[model samples]
Target: MANVIDTLFSASISRHVICVFLFISLVYTQNTVVFQPPFVTATGPTVTAFLLGNTSDVSLSLRTVSPSNTTGSIGSPSCTDEATRWVLTKEQIGKTAVRIKLRLNQSLHFCGENETSTNCCTKLLCVLEALQVTACVGNTPKASLLVQATINARLFPASAGNDNKTVIPNQVYQPLGPCPCDLTVRVCDIRCCCDKDCASEDLKLFASHCLPGPFGGQVSPDPDYQCSVQTSKNSPDWFPFLCVTSPPENNPYLGLFYHGSTITPKSGPSFQRQIVSAPLPVNMYVQGSPIITLNNQYFSIPQRVLGRCVNGAPVAFLENFQVECVTLLRSCPTGSPLQTLPADLSLKVMSGQGGNVVVHVTDKVVTDLNSFISKNNALSSAAQKLLCENVTLALDYKFFWQGNGITAVTLTRTIGTLISNVSVSLTTRYSAVFLNGNITAEPNSGNPGYQVGKPVIAGTMDNESESIQRAFISIWNPVGDGLCSTAEKKVVLFGKNSTSGCLLPVGQQTPPQCNLLRETVTNLQASLITSTYVAKRGNPDLLNLTDWMNISFVTLNSSTAMEDTASTCSGIPSHQHILVWSLVTGLVEGVPQREIRDLQIRYTLSTWAQDCGGGNSLCEDIQLFPITSSVTFIDIPVITEPPKARFQINFTEYDCNRNDVCWPELAFPITRYYTGEPYSQSLAKGMILVFCFITASILGTPWRQIRQVWHSIAL
Candidate 1:
């Protein structure tokens, strides 16, 4: 009886402690206060409550209900009836709070007042544990009120499967909890020896590659600390076991439970700053900075999205872009001009400084569908009937900036018909030029000396008129495999001398029809300049010795003209070579002036050798070869025999300023060395004179002493 009393006393003390803890939690927890409304009353199987907040619309959703604890004896009636355990209804009270009414069915029973309940309240057998009420207001932050009730005891212990907290997996697949390799059920996973479904045979085959146990299963003793030993090991024979290939798990992030500073992620910037209000701090613009615009709205560039025009794409600063989009036109205008589409609207240039916005330039798109049709003569006259066509081909933009911001902008629109219904083979180009806060001029090929990649200054000079005119030379450019008929002409760039060729057709006509081809070739060669004189600065200045010079042609061979066979196609030159000689003249303001000294063209006339297939009968199918031309530039100067050098010695008398003849203290020779000799050779000769004086002193003194000794011996 004394032991029973001690047990009862312990039970009473435990109940009292739990009641005190519950009261403390009710007063301290801020999140729980949102759920405990001012009034809650229960009648029979129904519950009614009034929630807080009158401005928002409140709605309730069931989250969780506590499980019932019933120890059933053998053969006892089973717990049944689903309809009796139903719950329902919620409504908003007029401008005061929300009213929630719940009706419980008869299948759920209330606990006895004196009984110790499990998984629910002592007074109630089945009770709500968690409920989420969402309150929403128009254009306001949504509020979520979460209500969770605490009980003295629960039927089931909390496990990973029952836990409400979410876990985000790492990028690399690693075993979490107990079964990382148990990814499939009722089937043996490949190379997964740890899978329970796998038989002994399957594990034997997987032994070569599969790891012994769960990957990354070892836990660090200290939650706040980590080391390399915790990293997951990789199987040598197998690739990423269950995830995309990743490096070793050296990342410091130790799951959400690790102790560290909580970091909330933020989104990237959606819009750029306006130019008018932006301060002038830096000269160059960064990648995401706003483009300078006249209006307060954001500046947008026309872009192509999936082959169609997407007009309002935000333009990034300091980015070069090009886009081509297909635009649909309803019809070619007959009486009235077609209205401009939003994509065809112009962009205005805004000054990148000051408080007030200023417009500096504006551009317009020029659409001439008629001109486009006329240019392509192959187009049918029914172009007007096919009015619903894709016409806009490309849009080009060039932005000019001066340190602080963009100062000018130019737009060029190229309108043309599309080859297909959906797309066009065109692009919009963008370029930015920094002027350093000044107007920029066109760049020159070279200031004085020629730049390496810059085009050579080449033109034709008239001998009779003494004038020069600029001209460009072109060569035959074969489209595919050097076919003659399909070849196009392309201009040659200076310094980039290259050879190209195309086959020429030969026809057997009465007066040798190839003569027309020969005449055309001669006319092109006639305009080439053989010799010319050029000035350094402007026109030739005769008085300036280094101002002007004459450049002429020189040939390697004695022959000046190509050899030709009369009345035959063989006379046509098969190959022609243009050789240019140039040299650096003088440097003007740190720029080298590379001047052309000589130029010559050598021609190799073809010879006809026929192998007759019809036994010496007039060879009908003669194999004619292609004509080729090549240009070569040599950076070598002309060579000439230098004049002989002469030497003269000059002697000046000391004090000669007052007297007619006074002996000088020093005199030197006036001499000139050969062009290739080193200037240090004169100093070497002076050193030789000093060596002679030292040698004479050593020999002459010894000879005088020997002679004196000889005289003494004779005496």
Candidate 2:
């Protein structure tokens, strides 16, 4: 117990020096002073230094100091000593003891290796001759470092050219940041797999340095940095995605990896490939003509033409004069023959009637004068006794008859007589009858002038020479005997006796000379009684006066009773009995006046005497005679012709899809959507479930725990 074990070794060396000063103050307040040669003076210094040893014994030294004006000159330098000789050098690697490693390619330097003097082999051969120098001259060598000790510190960004200067191992050196407000860490991607695979890819994988997140970790093998390679979501299916951020001085991990995927980009496909390459097609043509031209009438009969088609083809129009074919030949099929004409001819005549006759004859005996005694009893009694004994009648008579009846007869007569002279006086004797007469005193020679016995009046003493005597009686009379008399006493008379001769004066002796011969027979019987001789003897028996007293007593008793009866009946009277009794009484009286003159004849006659004897007649002696001969008729007139035909038309062109090859349907469908802003707020629905649960919890962690907590961060 050597003094009580010296108090237990002085209390265990003071509790082991208070547990080694509380483990060095808890590693100097949470082990964050890792500065292995880390140095950064303002902006430039020939050494950005750092080296915490392990990776093999720490030996990273970079030192550059120029800029001096006779202050502490090394190799005479100015111009601010090549602008403070930008520099960098780093080395800090430790595996257990709370791990820590960072070897920034040994560190950096310049300023001609600080005017060398074999200063660590001229600053490690001037950083290995600036890594085999390909091209680098000015300004890009700026340097910075602030690594303290214990652990947690990084500032990697070196490899520039010559095939990798080294610093990759899960790279991420995020630095540059300011310009344009840290423009995504000043246009990030400093190589090293474009800063850890395009910093979580997307944002069009940092699109060829149009930068933002392929930050400074310096590991460029290019292939656009293959961090397990994955980029192409088909390039966002075709363009458009941009995100850029960062600032307050740098590494905001490229503004948190491209600000949430470029605030919603993706969307492309060239507007649906330009709407399927621009579109167009649909057609029709038809101009005019399915046949037309009428009047010259080719109506082409189809019921009278009407067909149609317009925008396709085929058309016609003519109707009714005869030729129809309406609407694609409206079911045509009835005897077919489609039109024509010509044929009709004619002419005519016919007639009747033929009867009639008349003839009239008239004579009426022959007008007047007892019609020539009834046409002279038709004449031939030896022509009426040579026209009544040579035609001599007194008072100028005239009669005529010729042809057809009396055949011919004519008579005419005229005769004359008158004579006388007588005078005798007692105081003056006068006696006449000179040439054939007697003045009986020449013998009475005694004179009454000679004296006479007074009363004895010897007048018979014959001569009495009386101085007055005259005689002028030359009478030879035959006043009227122009006999046309049928009777009128067939006159028998004679008396021209100068005292006795040519006499037939009969009987009674004179006594005053028989009273002057009975006063000359009473004045010749009163001048032969005339009624125009009894109208020319128109027989009233000729107006007889006892036949004029029997013709004056038969010529004075035929010489005094035949000389005194010829001795008293002279032998008993026989003289052929008086001429046979007058020839039998004139043959029985001429057979009863010739049978009454042939019954008053009317024998008809008309010898065309020049056509009834008038002037200017011709034209076949115009008696015109046609009273009636013949004519008769009834209805009439006729002529005729017409009938013949044939004609055609058939045109067709129809097809609205009757298996006739498509094309004809468009009547109204075409609608397309999605343009940006997070797919248009993810197609609306209140931020699409809170941005799809924060992007599926950031891809469900474990990406090496966010790259070891972002490479133990201490920029």
Candidate 3:
């Protein structure tokens, strides 16, 4: 029994030793465990609290005067002690509440005992205590005071669904009642409004102030008050007070300084007051008187005679008049009162030769008279005698007397015979005369005194002339008369024999011979004279002889007889030789001298005669004569160049008086610019090249690129 007991004791001892070794090993390799109180309570007039250990196993301790006293409740002191206590544990981590009731003027402290007083002395104070329960695995432990409370209560570890028994969480606290307070005052820059008592109540905030010259003269704060200084007269400066004045009214007659004053004109006469003289009359012609008249048998006088004052006397003047015979005769009758009287006439008075006096007259019958008379008188006297003896006499006398002045005695002729089956003709020629003078004559009358028809013979007979015998033969027996009786004695024998039984001695001739001789004597008159008788039984007067009619018998017989024979000849005998002679004179007056100047006058004469050239023949001839006259008045001198002195002008020295010589010149400024080469060649060529290049690039490169891309995409 003693041995078994010894064995048991030995085994117990061994176990105890093992146990101690294991305890040492565990202590060497594992974390140490510190023992702390499970619960802590605090109650004191002033209290402080502390937490120890890590979050994994936290320790709570109370610092109070009587923390071990149980009789003191957590926040109040009991009758036996001045302190109270409570516990902090794992379950209380989030479910715990801390309350601190601080008295006025009392102080409480946290973390260490009485290290510093809390601000709760002026109010309630509270705090949250956190205990970090971290694992003892190579790390330091952290504990915190997370939440605090005063009259306001707070909880720690907050209310949450999941928790690690570690860190203390944040909490929210609310005041149980009105929180205790302390008051403070501060100053701020603002405007305040005043109350009725003038005390400020509301505030007005102001914008921030900007300093001057802040932007280095680039920007300005106030632009309205800016000013600039002017440098010269042309500067762009504004002055508000100045303005231009209005111009005064203009008047040319008044001086510039004499406004509103009456101006006196320089002395001169008005046009109405000037004196003017009348023009004097000019005398062109001197005055004189001259006589004028119109003869009764020739011209008709004007009914109202016009007169002009010449030498202080009114003188009757004649102008244009007409001359016509009362009887329808071409020539005035023999012994007619106006046959030798003046016809149309006019005259005027003149102080000098240059004065004008004109007379106009018409001589209707006088035209071609001189030419006719000249031709008729040219016929042989022997031809006249033959006609008288061969044929019974028949006389036709018609005459017109026309002249500007008195008509002088002119010749007349009577036709005593006409031969049957024979023709006689005469022709006249004309000449031109131009004269300048006035015509005067008597007034016209209806009856010019003369007998109508009667005849008387003049001049002595001559029996020896051969012309007389021819005249007798032609007058009584143009175609051969009855034969002479044998009892008749021939006073003149006209045969080729000198003596024959046909002749009878003188005085031995019987009554038949005397009768034959008387007949021969009657026919042998030298001049066959005719006269005008006023009545059937009135004594006849021979027509006044004029020098225009004188002619030799032989000459007359040779020319006249041949002419007569030739005129009456027929067939081949009509071509017998003939002779003619003529004399003529013409008078004219009152032709203007100027009209005759440089004048060409032409005269035309014509004749027609009948002849037998076996069957029938007519002869006609014309002659033209021209005369020219040039007149120049010696009274008026010729002037080749006229005077130009009236139009000549003279210039004086004062004509060009002027003070200023220069005047403003009109000018304009012209600006010139250089022109490039023609645009059509230079600019258009460059543009065309550029356009072609662009078009080619677009057409060729882009198209190729597009085609390549398209093909690749298709592949």
Better of 1 and 2 by TM-score: 1
Instruction: Please provide TM-scores, in order, for all candidate models, with all chains considered together.
Output: 0.30, 0.10, 0.11
lDDT of 2 by residue, 331-423 (tens): 112221211111100000000001111111111111112211111122233321221111111111011101000011111122111111211
Off by over 4 Å in 3: 1-322, 325-510, 513-524, 529-715
Which prediction has more favorable lDDT, 1 or 2? 1
How would you encode candidate 3's per-residue C-alpha lDDT over 380-465 as one tens digit per residue? 44433212121111111111111111111111221122222222331211111111111121111101111112111112223322
Per-residue lDDT over 485-507 for candidate 1, one digit per residue giving the tens place of the 0 to 100 score? 66665555446788887765554
lDDT of 1: 0.43
Q: Which candidate, 2 or 3, has the higher TM-score?
A: 3
Instruction: Note the residue pairs that clash in candidate 1.
Output: 84-105, 283-403, 322-428, 323-428, 449-592, 449-593
Ten-residue region with minimum lDDT total, candidate 1: 72-81
lDDT of model 1 at position 514: 58
* Candidate 2 lDDT score at position 17: 20
